[model samples]
Target: MQIQDLPYPDPGVPDARSGPRFLVWLGRNQLGGQLKALVWGLLHFLSVSALPFCVGFAVQAVVDRSGARLALAGGLLALCGFGIALGDTMLHRAAVTNWITAAARVQQLLARRTALLGSALTRRVAAGEIVAVSTGDVEKIGWFVEAVSRFTAAAVTVVLVCVALVVYQPALGVVVAVGLPVLALSVLPLLPRATRRADFQREKAGRATELASDTVAGLRVLRGIGGEELFLDRYRRASQEVRHAAVRSARMWALIHAIQVFLPGLLLIVVVWQGVHLAREGRITVGEMVTVYSAVMILTYPLRHFTEIAMAYSFSRPSARRAARVLSLERATDGEGSREALVPTGDLYDPATGLLAPEGRLTAVVCGDPDAAGELAERLGGHTAESSELPSALVGGVPLDELPLDFARRAVLVQDKDPVLLSGTLRELLDVPSSGDVSPAEALSAAQCGDVLDALVQGSLDADDPMDARITERGRSLSGGQRQRLALARSLVTAPGVLVLDEPTSAVDSHTEARIADGIRSLRQGRTTVVFTSSPLLLDHADRVVLVHEGEVAAVGVHRELLHSDVRYRAVVTRETDDEAAEQELNQLQELEEIEETA
Candidate 1:
């Protein structure tokens, strides 16, 4: 495929059986491109292989003192030159096209998988591993794929040259043919050791990459805790380990290279010695001996490709395996069939925790464990894995999982505790695909993001409109409270039928959070809204509060009623007992009396 035809409409499902199997699958998928590369490679290698014969003929003509034959030899040499030039150029073009197209196809598959898997992709694979696979690993796989054609052409050329040599002079041809195989096979014994070292190097490099990614991701936190040096030192050691492993692997490859050179040189010496003996015995003409010797020398180039192809395979095998592992991860669903949209007019019910977020009401969930609360929030929005044993979340009493993923997501929006803000302008960030009933201004006001807009306006001198102001990656330039509010505003703009928010106001102060809680309730008056929080300010504003203890719903009632009746609820929401409250109140009164007496 051409570069312009990129981002294939369907990258198509990969085999993902094993590393070698994946390579085979890639080759199968790009048969036309492979064939093009093979044809070009054959033409190129054939041109190269024909050169020794031209030289042999030229030498024969010179010995015979035939001007006509010499002129013919010159013409053949010119033709070979033209063939070499055209074949080399086109061969490179074809090989590079195959490499690029293969890489692009794999990249598209990765992109599709990432989109399909969403947040679960990160959970299953390390961020650095994913990065490495997409970047370096893809290139390695492409290298092997591109090498296949060239290796095939080289092998064929070697065989043809050997046969021609045998026809010209049997004794010299047999010696060269037998020795060529020895030179190629001698490196086989060293390959296992080299492969082991390469695998070790790859592992170390992956670890180093992972460490660097994690360190960079948490750089702000590391600096806050004054632990940058600790992390830096850890990264340093990891990088050193990677370097040492690479050096060891290089050493093994170097030995293999030495063997490749030494064996071929020995083979050339044997061929020359044999040819000299034949020439002395008058069994072969001087020109024929020269041809056999030149042919054997030319065979060296193709024979070296055997070792090169071996190296390419050795390096690419693990990379392909890693890529296959990533591509093999399937979503826990059928992920096919009709995607009928859900009717946006029902209570969100999770059978796992027996928690029901009723229609047109604000339901607050207070779980002792934040993680359980997050998971429950996800389930309520129908984001649970299809493989989960828990029953599907119900919307309007219909199974959420039974509906298509796109439909389910549209029907229920779940804003995670740590929501990400993609880099874009304020307007772009709020432009989500949904019912555009909620204006950006209204959503921003409800989310208490007025200050965020003002900050953006103040930061960008060229921005005539605050909505046009740019946001940095992950909203890193903004404070925690501003980022949280901005994310909430973006979510609100979607205006989904059911909104499940997990600790949406966790980072904000009490006054700002109180405003957000009240604003959300007012804005979503006739919509289903579930807030997973333990904050008293937000819980008190909810129509109904459900307390989740362990993994099940422990209590359900108004926030005030729970505070008065359930000690566990009080402990979580208020984090104080009645005795402590009384003690604090008495101490305040005593302090007031002491102040009056002093006055």
Candidate 2:
């Protein structure tokens, strides 16, 4: 539970029942740390609560003119001061430990969930929401967790002090006791309103954050489209809405603070007024009156904790709820399969769509709808959206989902249409868990990335070593085709038993696409390769081309056979009429001859 022992071996699955329940679960999970915080908090609050008694005793000693009593009072005061200093220091240490540990536990859980869900996480939850939950929301949850122990200790101190007062002076104690509960409970009615406003503010803030993230991610695209002003205005308006919602939330909380301050002030007034009358009428001594006044003033500190704890709970509840929602998202393959590893070396067959990529064959899937193609590509790698009800993809007569996740991943690598290249040196980017069959040079060559490497290293200090050149975030500094090729190169280096590529060369030129198509076929000569593409150059290179129409296989043949036989296939792959197709074919032939003659 200590900071040094962070990243718990088992950050255990969180209870995703509800917000309040999740918070309770967090407290339960860290019982040992919480107990330490509670003990220190109790000691700290007890020392604070003893200050009034020490002063009251000292006042009585002075009135009695007893040197022995005065000395005893001074000793008690010194002890209380020492306890306050030591207890406060230790309490702060324990509370901070609790906060850090709680936050770390939450972060670990989030990271595990993110890793499990992978790209599907962003599909299920906003990237901004994930960012918010991992950052600000986690801190808020930890703050509430850390505050609970202190709040409990403060409550205990308040009760113990009130009981001691009742024993010391029943009449004034009754007045103080009655007023204390009223002070604590006075703001309860306003809490619902404050919580509602706070939730609204959080909602608005999340939207604003999402908008900002989206805007920044697409800034380059926005500038290209000349839509920067439009997005900027949209973000500005979203930010303004967040500000307005926050102001509304603050107003409600301000009212609650006013009530917290006002009620305590009223209680202090009542205790002072009642004590003065009792002292003047000889019902209580001067020292007793001073004691009652001091007790009421000291009680205010603990009373403020009541409102603070409420505020903490209100903010953390929604944050916890969001975190729980993310944690609750179970992967489609989760809990439905065994942990047995399988080295799949057979065709990847999707029973739902009846699309099969035969083993050791370069199969091209041409789909009329790009969305359907993407889904099929995911299916080829045992990845399905959370909403998908499709049956498990099978390989070697074994369900891919039934295999251990690591085994399944190692067996089939799916490079999505929009693959991400993380910020790192080129060598680090290609350094993935692999079968060690393909070298960096071989993979890069198969991916047709020679031009990309040259571009990256052209003006760099490490010009001779392109692999050492740094890549910016998402490879944003690279061209679209360069990024795609780099992603393809990284995937090729893994050298999985099966590789599913979705539009691997869509961003590249026809000549480069032709080279990549040929290189891929040569590199993956004895492995299963499924390429979802409609490009003629890529389709022509496939050993077998399957035409997918309306989510089902419409035809299966070589690219040329399908073009001549299937009208839908031709429409999809060529995207031209009869005359246009003939004219394009003639132009390509003439261009090839001219290139051959010049060479």
Candidate 3:
């Protein structure tokens, strides 16, 4: 693929059977670019190899006192210089293109895989591991990919240079040619040790990254529980382990580099020594001695590529493996059933919990077990695993798991308890693939986020419009309630056929909660909406409230009726045990509602 044609329309199905296979697949797909790079690399290294011949011819011309031949040699030297310059420049360009394109392709594939798996991807892979794979690992993979062509060129140049030296003067040439292979192969014994150290360092670094991610994600909670220093100390230990491992890894590579430097220098010294003896004995010309000496020095340049390619492979192998592992993960619903968009808008039925939110109505589910509630919420949106042991939820008459993922998501949008707000402008955040039924203004008004808009404008440095103002990553700049309200507004803007919200207003005060409850009921009129919450404010607005006890629907009725009728429902909703006190609270809330209605 050309550099300009980056971000391929489709990266194609990857061979994720193994890390090595994946890397091979990447190279195969970019064979054209690799070949282009290889050709340039050949041109560049071949030009470099020709330089010593030009110098040897010039020296011979000088000794023979032939000015014409000397001038010809000068011309050849200039030509070779031009070739070296041209080839080197183009070779670098081609190699960098290959690197960037290869990295872009991998990123696109990873992004596609991420989209397919959604939240489940993180459940399977650690957040930090995923981060490392996408960032550092991708670069390493690209490094190896780009290094291949140059290494091939370098190897070919070494072989050609060795043969030419032998043909010119067999005595000195044979020794130099034989010694080159030994020099190249000498570092092989040290590679395994270096690779092991590198792997150890990579492991330590990955652990440290994972620890830091976990610590930052829960920084707020950590401070609340006074565990910041404990995590800090743990991270410090991990960081030190990473440092020590890196030092060990560096030491091994240092030895390899020393060997590379020392062996090449040794071979150079031997070649010069033998060439001088051949000159003294009149077995080889002085010009030949010069040629042999210069060629040996020139050959050392290509030899360095040997160690470089080794280093590239050593680092890239593990990176490719990590990327392969992530790509290999399949969504739980993948290949479970038909891949057709056959879902119809209707009631959401979770067979596992026997909970049904009827069509075109607001249904609130109160589950004492928060975990069970969250699971049920996920099931309603076809987020179940492929395991047949866990039954798929249904919509209309068809099982949600049987429908296509895109269709299921479009049909039902589930807002998690702690829904995330990604960084963007208010306009961008609300810019979803909506049904066009709800305008941003209407949704914002319904979500009671006027204050959120004001906050955005107030926080901005230049932009007066909240929609133009930038939101920080994860909306860290906003209050929890603000984030929740904005998320709710975004969900409302989508105007999905069925909207499922789990404790969407948990962070907001009761005053805002009651208004949000009214907003949800009003905006979602004639649409199927399922809310998993125990807040009486929200429950009271639901057309039907289902109380879930022991993972099953225990009771179903209007909120006020269930409050007085079912003891478990009352206990779960109000968190009150005394019937008298529960009624008293309910009465007070009823009075407030009446007064608001009168106002």
- TM-score for candidate 3: 0.93
- Model 2 scores worst on lDDT over the 10 consecutive residues at 334-343
* Candidate number achieving the greatest TM-score relative to the actual structure: 2
Model 1 per-residue lDDT tens digits across residues 145-199: 8888889888888887778777877888888777777877898988988888888
TM-score of each: 0.93, 0.94, 0.93
Per candidate, the number of residue pairs that clash is 0, 0, 0
Off by over 4 Å in 3: 335-343, 386-388, 576-599
Summarize candidate 3's per-residue lDDT along 1-599 as a digit string, tens digits.
Answer: 78788779999999998889999999999899899988988888988999898899999989999999999999999998888899899999999999999999999999999988877677689989998899999999999999999999999999988899889889988998899999999989899989888888888888898899878877877988999999999999999999999999899999999998898899888988888888899998888889888888888888889988988988888889899999998867744358555548778888888888899999999998898888788888878754536788788867877777788788889998877777878888999998999999889988999899999999999888878988887887888899999999999999999999999999999999999999999999999999999998898899999998997889999999988777788788878768766676678789989999999
Candidate 1 stretches with Cα past 4 Å from truth are 337-344, 385-387, 577-599
Q: After superposition, how far is residue 417 of candidate 2 from its true place, in Å?
A: 0.7
Candidate 3 Cα RMSD after full superposition onto the native fold (Å) = 5.5
TM-score of 2: 0.94
Clashing pairs in 3: none
For lDDT, the strongest prediction is 3
| Candidate 2 vs candidate 3, TM-score winner | 2
User: 386, model 1: CA deviation in Å?
Assistant: 7.0
lDDT of each: 0.85, 0.87, 0.88
